[model samples]
Target: MILAVGNIKGGVGKTTLAVNLTIALAQQGRDILLVDGDEQRTATTFTELRTEQLGQAGYTAVSLHGAAIRTQVMQLSPKYSDIVIDSGGRDTGSLRAALTVAETLLIPVQPRSFDIWAVDQVAELVKEAREINEGLRAFVILNGADAQGRDNEESAEALSEIEGLEFLPVSIGRRKAFPNAAATGRAVTEQTPKDSKAVEELAALLSAIQ
Candidate 1:
């Protein structure tokens, strides 16, 4: 499967989710390929940090931008069990290109009204993508959610109204473990004294994807 983690809005944790999810999938013994389709090259940097700082290369990572992602991924998908594309945040060439070939797309939104409003463009793009790629499946996940607040619930409720996108039940809350682990190129699950909530949240999201 080719999975692209993206959103129309930036700083909504697209690269973070892509990096962590790729590592988690690799740790599960799947042959995963991490593709940096974003011109920012955030995913490539994370893999580099993992190798340099932690001496652990989570998986094979390649940087391919713009329309290149569409062709390269289609060619490479047959070789790996899964390909995770970190397409940055925007309605760019690569973002549109990814939708052409990706089997699944995961869009993460913060629990805020602005975040909820930003999905309109992405939802439209998904509808267009599905016309050409009938197998394309897209989902929305509420990330950076408040652990014990109603904002997350409210966001999930709003997500239900979006057409052509399914909502993932699990929500990833604001946790220090995410940034702390990313600094050293680690997934929350790989942290020594794991944040139980972070682990739980990631596990649920992973289960839904698999």
Candidate 2:
């Protein structure tokens, strides 16, 4: 399956989810490809760090932008077990290009007023995307929510009002482990000592998507 972690909303943890989700999926022993569809190349940078620090990152990580991005992904999809796309934090052509080939789109939003408002725009895109790609599914995932606050609940409440996307019950809290894992070129679940909460959260998310 091809999964895309995307949103038009920047600073909402889209790249974070994209990179980590790729790592988590790869840890499942699946042959995964991480495609950096974003011009910023955040996912590509992560894999670079993985190569430098961890030595020989297991899977392929490449940047695929431009109008032909969708065509490229379609051609490459059959060669991997799963292809995960990470697009820029906006409604750019590359993002739209990614949507054309993605099976499911996961929109990760932070638990705040700004983030809550952003989901509406993407839901509209998803609704439109599904018109042409009937098998496409969209899910609203809560990311970086305060570990102890009503903001998470309130955000989920706001997400519930969205028409096209399904609200995912699973969420990833605002944990230092995310940045820490990124710094070390590993998933939070792959961190040394292993953060139990982070592991459990990611596990739930992977299960939800599957």
Candidate 3:
């Protein structure tokens, strides 16, 4: 299945979830292809940095932007079993191209009021994108919840704001290990196995997807 991690808002852990989720899926023995659709190339550079920092090989991360983006993704159909696309922050032609072909659209959002409000815009686009690909199941996954975990008031409020959307129960808590490991081009699973929040959350997410 092709999963596109996207959101219109920045600083909402969209790319982080995209990268780590790809790593988690890869570790599960699945052949993964990560498409970096963002113009910033955050995911692509993060993979390279992590690989060098942890001395591990990074998986395939390609920039699928511009006019030929759709063709490029379609070309990848025969090469990998699974594809995870990291979309740009706002609506763009390339992002639309990705959503057009994606089987499931996984929109990662922080459990905050502001982020919750932004979901409407994304949902509208998801509906539009689905016209071209009816099988696309788009849902919001909570990313970077506060210290109180899922029970936090803000988290609850955020969930309430977006009615009828499937919420992934496993919320990735705000942790330094994620960014720290990313700083060195490594995933939390590789950087600190004992601190299992990142891996556990991602594993739960993958299970939810399957």
Candidate 4:
């Protein structure tokens, strides 16, 4: 499967989710490819850190932008069990190109008004992409959700109203375990002094994807 992690809004944890998903899939023994479609190259940096700290990144990582994202990913798809693309925050060529080839698109949004508003833009993009790629499936996952509030519920409600995107029930809360583990090029599941809740949440999200 080719999955793209993207959203029009920045700071919504797109890279975090993409990187973690890539590493987690690799840990599951799948032949994974991590594509850094964003200009920021955060995913590339994370893979480098993983290579430095663990001597192996566990999966292949590459940087591809613009129309090359679609062409290159299509050519490379046969070599891996799955490809996870970390697209840019805005509606750039890279993001648009990624949508053309990806079978699944995961749009992570924070439980905030701004992030909720950004969904419409993403929906429009997905609508356009679906015209060309009929098999595209877009899902919205709430990230950085508050543990004790109706914000998550409100966000999910708003997402459900969007025609092109499906609202995923899995919510990843504002947990320190995410960044703590990412600092060492690790998934929350592999972090020391384990945060069972974080691991469980991620596992549930992965299960939903499958």
lDDT of 1 by residue, 108-178 (tens): 99999999998888999899888898888899999999868789889999997899999988889999999
**What shift in Å separates residue 106 of candidate 2 from its native position after superposition?**
0.5
For candidate 3, write residues 18-60 as lDDT tens digits. Answer: 8887887788788888998898999988877866766764468
Off by over 4 Å in 2: none
Q: Which stretches of candidate 1 lie over 4 Å from their true place?
A: none
Residue pairs that clash (backbone atoms under 3 angstroms), model 4? none
- Model 4: lDDT to the true structure: 0.92
Cα lDDT, all candidates: 0.89, 0.84, 0.77, 0.92
- Each candidate structure's TM-score, on Cα atoms with residue i matched to residue i, is 0.97, 0.96, 0.89, 0.98
Regions of candidate 3 where Cα sits further than 4 Å from its true position:
54-56, 149-164
The alpha-carbon deviation from the true structure for residue 95 of candidate 3, after best TM-score superposition, in angstroms, is 2.4
Best of the two (2, 3) by TM-score: 2
Quick one: how many clashes does candidate 4 have? 0
TM-score, model 2 to reference: 0.96
- Over 4 Å off in model 4, which ranges? none
- Supply the TM-score for candidate 1: 0.97
Clashes per candidate (backbone, < 3 Å): 0, 0, 3, 0
